[model samples]
Target: MCYQLVERFSACRCLYFQHAVDPCEAYRQRGHSVQEKVVLVGYTCSRHSMRWSGNKARDSTLSDSGYSSIKG
Candidate 1:
């Protein structure tokens, strides 16, 4: 039996990282079966995560300044 770990970003479902394959005697054999373990990270990747937080901060600031009437 072989196992491969896949890590993904929770928000955008993007491939965040991958671990090395844990190979066994049956690895690469004709009838080999690979077990995949997927892990969803708690947060989004750095790129998108920062953008989301920044947007929240900006929105809050706008609301606090009595500018909520402004529409996109």
Candidate 2:
């Protein structure tokens, strides 16, 4: 039996990558005969992935510096 490797997106389960094996003629005779070994990537596909907004504010405080004034 011949086996093929398939990589898919973890989130959407979309086809990301594939490695095909040189299957024998007997295997090709039957439709969809190649055995698929599915390997899920850690990240999602670009189309289904999330994007972070650059315009969002990091902090609401007026001071950007880490240190604050210590009043006695």
Candidate 3:
């Protein structure tokens, strides 16, 4: 329900931001034990109108892991 004209930045590290714009609640997709856990994380830049995701096992969120947001 967020109608704010948000701006997206390449360096911006915000996952909940995607949820603000998208209909489906975008959450950190987590993995399982045997194959190692994976958290689906991404960033959205409204100003640039660009959305990018670090779909790698290493790319983790601030809340998910100790590392910072993925910047690429």
Candidates arranged by lDDT, highest first: 1, 2, 3
Which is the winner by TM-score between candidate 2 and candidate 3?
2
TM-score for every candidate vs. truth? 0.56, 0.54, 0.15
Runs of candidate 2 exceeding 4 Å displacement: 22-32, 51-72
Tell me the TM-score of model 3.
0.15
TM-score of 1: 0.56
Where does the lowest 10-residue lDDT sum fall in candidate 1? 58-67
C-alpha root-mean-square deviation, each candidate = 13.6, 15.9, 17.3
Whole-structure CA lDDT of model 2: 0.63
How do these models rank on TM-score, best leading?
Answer: 1, 2, 3
* Model 2: per-residue Cα lDDT over 29-49, one tens digit each: 656577888877645565655
Q: Which candidate ranks first by TM-score, i.e. highest?
A: 1
lDDT of model number 3: 0.34
Per candidate, the number of residue pairs that clash is: 0, 0, 7
Compared with the true structure, all predictions reach lDDT values of 0.65, 0.63, 0.34
Deviation in Å, model 1, residue 31 alpha carbon: 3.2
Q: What is the alpha-carbon lDDT of model 1 when measured against the actual structure?
A: 0.65
Off by over 4 Å in 1: 46-72
* lDDT string, candidate 3, 6-50, tens digits: 323324543343323332233333531122223333333343333
Give every collision pair in model 2.
none
Quote the lDDT for 45 in model 1.
58
